[model samples]
Target chain A: MNKYLERLYNGLIKENPTFVLMLGMCPTLAVTSSAINGLGMGLSTTVVLVFSNLLISAFRKVIPDGVRMPAFIVVVASLVTVVQFIMQAYTPSLSDSLGVYIPLIVVNCIILGRAESYASKNPVLPSIFDGLGMGLGFTVGLTLIGLFRELLGAGQIFGFQVLSLSWFTPITIFVMAPGAFLVLACLVAVMNIVRKKMDAKGKPLAAPTGCITGDCAGCGMSATCTGKRTADHTVKTE
Target chain B: MKELLLIAIGSAIVNNVVLSQFLGICPFLGVSKKTETAAGMGGAVVFVITIASFVTALIYKFILANEYLLRKGIDLTYLQTIVFILVIAALVQFVEMFLKKSMPSLYQSLGVYLPLITTNCAVLGVALTNVTKEYNILESVVNGLATAVGFLIAIVLMAGLREKIEYNDIPKPFQGTAIVLVTACLMSIAFMGFSGMI
Candidate 1:
């Protein structure tokens, strides 16, 4: 595989930030009440991630080690504010629906995690692709979860009712908080089962254990995956 | 006072910071494997969140929200994300240093978890929520404390549950985080009973 495609595949399947790595669970569970909300949040985050990764990677050498974490955060927070203003102006309802979460994106582990782990180390293009890959992975993960919940919870997919009203009673719990956990847990378990089968066939999605043993070469957090290197953890060590 | 009490209850139980709002889940899942560590992490979160919220509230009320400051062409509201996150980071650092110097044992127990709180969405979420909800300084502080307490309650309860599950014969696939998450789902279902309690 091409290096760029590798980055994309790395984020999408090999080390999916959501399902495989479990990096950004907060937003994955929060804004995924419906398919549209999940898509909106995911795309918005992708925009932020792509740009932040690009900028952070470009300026990697310039940002001082002592204050790199603070610098990365300032960059991400500014990007989030810009995104928030644009969303508020054009997509008022979407903005309102995602409320507080837009700002909370500043704390979303995926962006900062990517910045610290991949973007800050790699070159500009690869970092950008990495961000796009991770963002897409997160988007797909959230959307799938949203699709499941919305279908069961509201008998709708992206506001279009699929199951006729008389056909079944929408399970209200599927749209609630518990449903988020249940769906995520089930999906992850399914993913594990699939991986087991894949491994039996001599294929593996990601390393069996985390980025441990340095097998995860391009991974951003490889330097201090063990959490012992406080200097590498930066600001939001999520 | 009654209103504050209601807000406290509302944040602490009715709309819990963890189960309901889904903030601060990384620490909720990561540090919750052991009961003692969970309690320590909860205490650290409570301390950091309460203080961070208080400081952010004061910054918002006095500097960001001031009409005089706005008239002078300084709009700090746009900087809330950067400001709030920087504040939380600094505050966590301060707490870590203080703990290490004055209470080494406590610091040793809660060492790595302290840094993680800087990124914990609960702290920043409570700070941002305080602003969005139009909470005054006092209300914001109360909300922060209450939210942290809510986090404390949920994580401690999870820790207790996880301890019990250690001995239970569980299926292979669900042995680790999957089973713990399913447990959390059940807990979330149970906590849902608190809806509308306020």
Candidate 2:
């Protein structure tokens, strides 16, 4: 496989950001109330992720080592603002539904985690692919959750009636706040089962390194989870 | 007075930052292993978010508002996200230094979590919420405090339950985060009842 393609595959499957790594739980759980909302949020995040990765990787040499976090943040924030404006200009309804989450993407751990651990070290093209792969993985994860919740909660999928209304009363709770948590739990449990099955076949899923704890400190992870090492870790202070 | 109380009650319980709104799940999940640590993190969040809310509100009202910026047909509203993130980063650093010098004991407990707070979405979320809702500084502070308190309540409760679940004989696939998430699901359901209170 081409190295670029490998990066894509890595993000989409082996180290799926949403499920396997669990990096951006805030957006993953929040905007997934409906299928369309989930898709919109995921695509918007993907745009930010791809462009930020490109810019960061392209400028990896010039960014001083000590201030990488803020640099990554500034780059990501600018990209998010661009995406925010585009979203507002083109898709007003989705913009209204997503609301504060667009700005909140600036703080998402996935973008920072990728910048610190991957893009900062890799070249521009591969970084872009990595971003695309991870973005698509996140999109798939969120969209599936949204579809399930929307189908159950509203007896429909993306506003189309999939389940007939007479028999299925639309498990309304599935679309509410609690529904997001429950759906995520079930999906994660299923992923665990698949991992176990794959493990039995002597082909185990790749265990993700760093950012496992979802802390900003974890974003600096290279080999081990720096945030998990309370006393031993010597982090670079800016 | 009644309105302020309602806002407090509404944000703190009816619309919890963690359980319902899902603003700070990263820290809510990460720092919630032990009950004691959870409480400490909650304290740090309350301090940072309350101050952030206050400061960001003032900036929005005074500095970032298009009326205040040049006032010559230049709308700087597009800079909101970038400005907010920078303000939060600088604010967290300043708070850490001030806490360390002025109150060593408080710093000792919250110092570790302070760096982590800069990336926590709840701080920025409250700020943006204040802006979108057009809240005055006072209302923003109250809402921010109430949201942080809500986060504290949810995280502490999650930690307590995780402690109990730690000893239980769980299924193989449901161990670790999956189980924790399941616990969160139930807690989320429990919190849903609070919606009727306000």
Candidate 3:
């Protein structure tokens, strides 16, 4: 695989920020109430991620380690603001639907995580590819969750009535907050089954535990989880 | 007073920051393994979010408002994201320092989580939501406090459930986040029953 292509594959499959790594749960669960909303949120986040990664990579040498987190945030936040303005002007409905989430993108773990882990260490081009891959993976994850939720919750796909509402009473819960969790849980479990099958076939899976690598710190399982140390040590102060 | 009470209750329950609004989910999931940790995190979140909300509301009203920024011959509304995030980052840092000095043990317990709070979406979500809702300073503070309290409630409950589930015979795949999420789903459903309360 070409290096850039490798980055893409890594993000989309190996370490997918959404399905694989499970970063940015806020937007993953929140905006994914509908297919269209998920796609909009995904693409908007992609643009921010790509540009922020590019800029951070380009300035990796200049950003001091002590203030790096705040600096990365400023970069990501500025890009988000620009994206917000563009969406507000060009796509009013998306802008409105996404609402506070658009601005909240500033705190999205994927963007900052990519910036800290990949972009700041790598050269510009690969970092861009990394961002693109991760963003696409997130988009795919969100869109799938959204599609499932929207179909069941509203008997609609992208606002078109796919399942007739009269014949099928929409399982409205699928589109609500609870629905997001249920769908995500099922999807991840399914993904785990598939990964386990593949691993049994001698294929390399993304992370250990197939799809869900439970980091103790993030999961508050530090007292019980043995995998806590790796995350804490790898985390840079900036 | 009734309206304020309603707003507080509504945010804490009906429009819960975690169960409904889906903010601060990272911490809600991550720091919620233990009830004690969850409680501490909740307290820390309440402090940070309440302060961030108050400060951001002031910034929005006194500085970032269209009328105020227009005086400088620029709309500057476009700067909202950058400005809000910076305020949150700075504010979290300040709080970390204050806690470290003013209350050593509290700071020690919060420890790494204090810095982590800077990126928690709930802090920024409340600030931005407050702006969007056109809330006054008092309202923003109340909303932030209520939201964090809601977060505290959800996380502590989740931690208790998670601890119990640890002993249960769970399926292999659902052992980690999947089961936790499913549990959260049930909790979310339970919280949905509160939606009509307001």
Candidate 4:
């Protein structure tokens, strides 16, 4: 139970898919123009992620290693189909708002990454929790960016008027491509600063290194201090 | 012919896949570092997107939306993502095999990027967007081609700028990706100038 909780917590903040790992930047930037849109995308992705992780974990041993990637993609695509249909039928507004992003979630590296890394190796329960946690983390990160952008860019939060329009001229750029980059950059900078402060006070920050480059062996920081110190020393000596 | 040209130009310049519509951003940022490589990637994307759009459109119109399928109460619109992915994956595999057999040099240049395009949201996005917009087959093809060209233009321009930035003295923290993103922001702002043109 404690281990499950630990994994969940780690995924939410320490190894957040969007902010910390930067796994799926396409949807992160593209769909986050408004808070509602961001939430919609985030939840839709979460549903797909959780179900795909569960199914993949259950069938991990059966899937041959050679064809695992294609297999994983098939599972993700099917799950994305389910979510897309449900959204289109029940939440047409969100479906429209999310646009092509909901379908693009099938290609999102985070879902495939989790399935390959955690779900394929871990037990079913832990894998499910991992998915939920990671999905929630991505949702929170996207929503935060969306909230910031919407509030400043359009003076609204989830279409509710949060600020008086007369007081400020909305920075329309925040709702644009440049705004996505600006918000993401600031979020990353802030995360880095927070991590630095945490490290200074003896609380170790979460260091998720297997994402993006997918070269855990080549990362220098992991070698010096993590749990695999003996292996790290051996590699260094060689 | 003029309308088709207008559609192409509109997609390519005014409503760019990357800057305006926010499609295919992964490759726009990921593969747009070197001008030569960007051009190669752009060519590959142009081929993939244009071809995939035509194929997917035909499938959606002929098979999925066929009267028989509708009578059976099976709206395959729900399966758009799955079907499109399968089609794309198969198409990419076929292309890979053809390239390996016919033009090894071109294959080698585009070898690594080919697999990456399988999961490119831009290709799938264009296909899905075409269906939603209810574009006729010819218009869909033109839109897909133009969107790819737009991506090519944006990435090539970005690559040139990044190449120039490499020679300049950039700041400490904003040296690599941070600086590139800042540059992209400025580029996007500049591209917004074209929004009013249409």
Candidate 5:
């Protein structure tokens, strides 16, 4: 139970798929024009992710090593189909709003990444928790961005008039493509600043401290007695 | 023919797959570092998208759209995602085999991109979107081709810019992905100028 909780916590905050790892920006940016669309897409993806992870983790051992990727893809595709049908039947509005993004969830690197990294190695219960946690994290992150965009762009939240006034002229760019990039850039910058401040105060940064490439040798944040040795190699060639 | 050509150009340029529709961004950022690699990746996408669109349309119209299937209560629309992925996977396999046998150099240039196209959202998105829009076979094929070309153009341009950025003095923090994203933001903004054009 503790392990499951830890996985959930890790996925939601410490290692968020969107804001932290920065995977699956396509749908993150494309469908986030409105809060409702973002939530719908996020929940749909969560459904697919949770089911696929559970099934994949359960059959991980039985699947041969050589054919693992294809096998995982098959599982994910099937799950996505099921979710699509459910969405079409129950939530037609969300199904229509998400448009192609709902089906495109099958190709999202986050799901495949988790399937390959965690679910394929872990037990079913843990994988389920991981999926739920990561999905929730993605949902939260997307919803926040969507809220920010929708409120500022159209003076509304979830299609409701949240801020209506004669003086309030919505910034149209907030709902545009550039708006997604601007919001994402600001979020990443804020995260980096927060991480840096924590480091300066001698506090442990969230998640395991490591370089983006999973290598410590060339990382700028690493502390080592021999850090000066590779100083030249670490210099940016560009 | 002219209308089709216009649609191809319009989709490829005015409504780009990556910059405009926000499809296939994983490879856009991941593989757009080098011009040669980006071109190869773009070509692989073009190949897969074109083929997948045709095949999926056939499946939707002939099998799924048949009144008999609807009367039998066998709405295969539920199987859209699974079938599209399977078709894409099979198409990618076929292309890889053909390239490996006939054009090893091309295969090597494409490298892992050929298989990666199987998971690219743009390929599947185009296929599924065609079904949603209810485009005829010819229209679907044209849209797929145009969308792939649009993706190719965006990625290639991005690679070119990234290659040039390699020579420029970038800031400490916004050097790699950050700067590229900023550039992409600008590109997307510029592309938005076409929104009212179409």
Candidate 6:
């Protein structure tokens, strides 16, 4: 596979951001009440991620090492602001349904994580691909979760009534806050099962870049991932 | 006063920073393995969020959203995200320096947490939410405090539950974050019960 394809494959399957890296848990659980919300959030994030990655990679030579983070934030914040405005104008309903989350994308860990680990070092083309791949992976993960919740919660998929209203009393809670947590949990567990089976079939999966085993100290983004979480961790060492 | 009380209760219990609003979830899941750390993170979040919200609100009202600027056709409100983030970063640094000089012991405890939260979406989220809700400074601070308290309650409960969960014979796939999330799912449902209170 070429470099671009490899990046796509890696993001979609090998190290899926939602399932494996679990980078941006806040938005993942928040706006995924409907399939449309998830898709919009995902695509908007993709646009921001790709542009930021592209810009950062192009300016890699000029950004001072000491101030790279702030510089990256400015670029990303600008992109996110543009995306938010576009959503508000073009897709007013999605903008409303997504609510404050559209603005909160300024701090989504995946964009920053990709910038820090990929875009800052690699060439421009690859960084863009990396952003695209990661963004799409997150989109798929969110859409799947939203579909399940919408199907079960409102007896509808994308506001179209799928489950017959006569019998399927929309679980209601599934559309609320709890359902987000439950659906993501079940999806991840199923992914885990699939991984185990794939391993048994001699098609081993790649481990996620971040520590899924709860070892933040060893992870690259430990400080931002969890604030001094390692400080109070019993298993951590100097 | 009644309105303030309603806002406090609504933000803390009914809306719930962690369980419902879904801000600060990375720490909610990451630091929640131990009750002690969870509470520490919660406390730090409260401290940071209240101060950040207060400062951001003042800036937005007086500087960014000033009618003087608006009359000049200068709508700097679009710079809200970038400016707020810069302010948060600078504010954390300023606080760290002040704490180290005037309150070393406090710094020792909180210094470790300051940098970690500079990029935390909750800090910026609360700031933006204040503007979106058109909350005054006092109201913003109250909302921030209540939101932090909600986070504290939820994380502490999750940590306590996780400690008990460690001993259970969990299924293979539901071992780590999967089970923790399931626990969170149930907790979210319980939190939903508070919706009627307001």
Spell out the clash pairs found in candidate 6: none
Q: Each predicted complex: what DockQ? A: 0.54, 0.59, 0.53, 0.29, 0.30, 0.62
| Model 2: colliding residue pairs | none
Global local distance difference test of model 2: 0.83
Candidate 3 clashing pairs? A218-B30
Output the lDDT of residue A136, model 3: 93
lDDT for residue A68 in candidate 1, whole number 0-100: 80
lDDT (Cα, tens digit) per residue for candidate 3, span B64-176: 77585688797666677789888887788788888878999988777557766776789989988888888899999999999899998999999999999989998998867
Ranked by lDDT, the better of candidates 2 and 4 is 2
- Interface RMSD for each candidate model? 4.2, 2.7, 4.5, 6.9, 8.1, 2.6
- B39-146 per-residue lDDT for model 1 (tens digits): 988988888889999999999888777789888888878888888988887888788889889999988877666876776788989999999999998999899999
Report the C-alpha lDDT of model 2 over B50-70, residue by residue, as the tens digit. Answer: 999999988887777747466
Q: Quote the lDDT for B10 in model 4.
A: 85
- Indicate the docking level reached by candidate 4: acceptable
C-alpha lDDT of all candidate models, in order = 0.82, 0.83, 0.82, 0.78, 0.77, 0.83
Candidate topping DockQ: 6
Per-residue CA lDDT of model 5 for A39-79, tens digit only, reads: 88888888888998999999999999777877877898888
Best by TM-score: 6
Q: Write the per-residue lDDT of candidate 4 for residues B93-176, one digit (tens) a residue.
A: 788789889999988777656655776778888998888888889999999999999999999999999989989996554554
Top-down TM-score ranking: 6, 2, 1, 3, 4, 5
Candidate 5: lDDT of A213? 19
What DockQ was computed for model 2? Answer: 0.59
Candidate 3, residue A158: lDDT:
94
Model 2 per-residue lDDT tens digits across residues A1-238: 9998998898888888777766678898899988899999999988888999999999999998877777888899899999998999999999999999998989877787788778999999999999999898889878888888999899888989989998889888889888888887776677789878888999976543323343344453222222232523343322
Ranking of all candidate structures by their lDDT, best first: 6, 2, 1, 3, 4, 5
Candidate 6 residue A224 Cα shift, in angstroms, is: 8.0
Task: Show where candidate 5 strays beyond 4 Å.
Answer: A198-238, B64-73, B167-171
